[model samples]
Target chain A: MNSSLITTKTQRHKEKHYEVSAPSVTQWWSWFKDHHEDTKSTKKNDMSSDGNNFRSALVIGYGNTLRGDDAAGVRVAEELARRHPALRCLSVHQLTPELAHDIAEVDRVFFVDADAMADHVYAESVEQTPARSVRSHSLSPTSLLSLARDLYGHAPRQAHVIGIPAREFDLSEDLSPAARTGVAEAVECVGAMLERS
Target chain B: MTKTITISPVTRIEGHAKITIALQPNGDVAETRFHVNEFRGFEKFTEGRLMWEMPGITSRICGICPASHLVTSAKAGDDILAVEVPETAEKLRRMLTLAQWLQSHALSFFHLSSPDFLLGFDSDPATRNVFGLIGHDKELALKGIRLRKFGQEVIEILGGRKIHTPWTVPGGVRDPLTAENRDRMLAWIPEARQTVGIALETIKKVHAKYKNEITEFGNFRSLFVGLVSKDGALEYYDGFLRIMDGNGNTIADKLDPKKFEEYFGEAVESWSWLKFPYFKQFGYPDGMYRVGPLARVNICDFIETPEAEEERKVFKKLSGNVGVVNNSFYYHYARCIEMLFAVEKIEQLLNDPAILGTTIRSQASINRTEGVGFCEAPRGVLFHRYKVNKDGVIQQANLIIATAQNNIAMNRTVHQIAAHFIDGKKGKITEGMLNRVEAGIRCYDPCLSCSTHALGQMPLHVELFDANGSLLDSVTRS
Candidate 1:
């Protein structure tokens, strides 16, 4: 691990309380803040009234809408974007190799996508370090980051996987009850992550 | 009355076909037609879709060479957008396209066309298959299939979706390649080279035994058209086109295929839905041209790699330099050479660090205009022209597919093969002769699916009438 990761390990031990100090990649997190601000119009808006300040957090949700419960992530992204004015939101469905290079350059990134059901549960997020799992997509987040580092030498500072356990991946355009619940919870969880960031 | 032979289920190909042969009661030549029996409506279904979605959507039309159509359509959209893409993007597309050629042509030549060459043309029909091929020579069968699969794997890895590539798009590609992926692709090269070496050995054996089949199966003269580098190198992925005569003399060079309207024309036959493309200067069957392996072999002055160069040397030595080869059957030789060339090319393209660079796609805005996309499909030259509105919706599209481009020539070559090789004795006019004629067509690897359709029957048909409009006799399949 790098010095920042080591420093965070020590800080967590000393505090003994669950307090994430945000991404220490200063140039990177500040980048998110600057761009998130730059993209907005010059106006002083009350953040507490706007569903609390989203601040410098970037929330991304991706999945296909017509793919049954597989659309959970996108639905969550859509809701989050509406709720938090400060949250930078993007909902990409069909990712391709063509997008790999650019996607891997973020200081901190969160991917919200649909996945095959886990233990047949509604949804689950991997809370710790990611294990090497083969992505259903050739241009999965890990592979894309590998590509960025290999081809472009610019891997993002942080990436977290928010996988919504999906019940169906059929060709239908409707969402199941379980999938709907997963999306709501995912939105809530992402709202929490944004507050921490 | 005329008699006919109909094979309603033509198997062992990507799709289905029904072939009918017509002959007179007394066994006189009448008319011959290759009929297409199945239809998949890709064009009608793809309408109203985001024009950028065409590449992936159109690819599903055929599983055999989906990448060809995918790349062609993607380029079409890109061209219409009037965006000047980055060089890296163009090169990456070409590299992917060449990979498609390597796999598709390998499938066409070694998998589909090999049984005829390996087994005797007169071999029992039931035994003329991959099983039979394995029984004849197990190692050759294994080697060929493995090589084909490797090509498929490479495409799948790079494009994300292999059979239906969703990665290509308007401004360039949607993503870029990394050093890790490039290294993975490069690892396959040396083995690919060895596989070609084995294939070349098989080529020599097959050619030696089937000398007459090689030389006279489809012996006829026609104009040949193919894509070659501006520098006259054999380039399948990107290049201006050159049309050469039977004697290998250049009729046209650096001809903007987009301006094909100026030099090329198509005629429709009453019997076949496929359009017969011909040179405007020559007209109809007279202006007919052959493409794919035969044309590629004829047009280019140089082969890029050492293995392909050596094979070219042997080809030129067997047939005298450029002008000596005229038989359609010799296309097998050209196919082998191209396969070798593709293997070498993959290594060269992937090794460039630029291939693994950050700019796989250009970060430019897109506009709308009329544009044409041209690339050499494994079977032949494929052209896609599109006109997009200011809002970037497709206004109109015209596609001249590789198989459609060879319709007139396929008919003429079939006629020539039947005339030259079939014996006068009716009993000796064997299945071998028909298969030989079909094999010649197979050499071009015509995708009748890409062409509009074929009417029916596969034999000479003739109707006799007196000068005074008196009907004498009607002849069908013999």
Candidate 2:
């Protein structure tokens, strides 16, 4: 397959770099500034906040968009943006240490990923489980929380793994039938969870 | 009876590999071999794909250094289209390459090798890792992680993703650097530079303590090969191939990448699936040479960056300013110097106005039936050659991976260390000895994923056998 011909959401997103004059540019600029500026440190104890204080949530949707059905996480993340536009969402290939600082300041974190082993979509609470040793490229949600705790002295107050059951992993752009259904379920589940939060 | 002691799947490396040391009946090391045991036919799968897909597809070869493959394959695409990459694209490519160097070298030093030095080689394996380094010194460990994060962040900003970024195409990159992203990248340089400075100083102090390791580990005389600028300075993105002798003599210079077949040859060995690449002039094992940080430092005339330039001087003075430093243990020191240079280079590129230019690609059609591209990967020099049909469909592909290029040198180094540390006596086969043997290979930081290009996981298992071929003991790390 001509992978170059297969334009991914990432490629399309990058192509948007040239269209900076678009109407949404100002909105994106604001979002970028608010999310990125002065985010280098998040050392405040997220769990120590008063029960009545507002809690900020970080929603990370990670998957390879090029692989069939593997893009479910990214799809759910994109859908979450539409359903809950005010939420902080990051679309990535995987969880990395750089996200630790971001995770540290947030009171809640939702890690959305595609799981081939899962028979159905599900959401479960995830606890900090720091790796004995770390590979910079291979951090998981638990590891990122652990890293936040280790480096920043605190992790998010609550973290949940939102898993979308995936059936196909081959090199293709189309999601599987079950995965398409799973994406909707994941989006609804995440939307409900965000509402309850 | 001769006894064999094996250390399987040297831990904390990018991929799996093992080392076997044979002990003679009289309690002296007899032989040693470095084994790569996995096969992923990446080349075979590439046959019939559109040539433009290579940069994207081949980037999957190794997660650690996928940027290297992506950049190198794109260069090959450049050759096929016969179009000069725009100045902005070149700058971006250089910046990306350096970022990769920064992250990859940091990994080798802090995560893989530092634990052995800081925690002591004889320390418990469980604690002798990056975590141990963190427990022993939190600031240093955190600095290492942040330094790596800086590189990965730069990559993500430029390519839109960390691993398997399809941003790099045949003629140029997919997107140009925005002024915002440029400033964003520039913002990270000061801290990145400071971290590398800290690491360099720490390694120098650590190096001073490892007198025996420096003297005995993988110290041998062989040739060195790497890319050098026209003026014989350090060049990683693009340069002429230069070869230097182990004792610091220039053997050959300005060998064209297109003409590599004339001076490079690959020899297949029955025991290892990885091809043993050697200098054609010297032939087989005799032409064996080392690459990666050690070879880059050895073969380069000078580092252009200021801090690294000064570090180079110290390195030269320490090693008599010779053309090559035969000791592989110095690879750690060389890695630090390169990381410093990469950080400096990144800052330089980010400041360049052309980096903000939007004209990153040069549109072109198929202009050549075959093309070859070569670049210095984080591990060493990597070459990718492709033959395409008139319609741009790849007919055949050949990848000369860096680790395979260092196979002969790694095997010889394994033998050298095995002989230095091993004896037939039971006590000689201590964990420290095993570590030193593994340390010899670690000097190369061999990425078996890139070398073997294999499917499935390959865990390390070291086996000890008597002359009669009976298993005496084995240690397997999964």
Instruction: Name every residue pair that clashes in candidate 2.
Output: B9-B460, B27-B424, B39-B454, B40-B453, B40-B454
Computed on C-alphas against the true complex, the DockQ of each candidate is 0.02, 0.10
lDDT of each residue in B1-478, candidate 2, tens digit only = 6788877766655555667777787668888878776665678878999999999888866667778988999999999999999999988888888888988888788767888899988887767776678789888878888898888888889998545757988899999888888888888888888889988888888888988888888788988889999998999999898998977888899988777878889998777778898898898879898888888888888999898989988887766655567888989999999999999888888887888998999999999999998888998998999999999999999998898988998888888877777665663346777888887788888877533211113455767777766787777653
TM-score of each: 0.65, 0.81
User: Candidate 1 docking category?
Assistant: incorrect
Worst 10 residues of 1 chain A by lDDT: A130-139
Q: Write down the worst ten-residue block by lDDT for model 1 chain B.
A: B450-459
- Chain B TM-score, one value per candidate, order as shown: 0.88, 0.96
Write the residue-wise lDDT of candidate 2 on A1-197 in tens digits. 11232233344345456752222223433443454453222222122121222238878887656566767887888776655545767776555456787898888888888877555665666745665644323455766787688777989877877766787866555889988988887765555454435
lDDT of 1 by residue, A1-197 (tens): 12232233235335345554423333333443544553222232225214333443445565545446766776777787777666666665433333333445455556677756332112222233321221111134554454334344456565556655577755444677776766766665555444434
Candidate 1's DockQ = 0.02
Q: TM-score of chain A for each candidate? A: 0.60, 0.70
Index of the highest-lDDT prediction:
2
**Model 1 shows how many backbone clashes?**
19
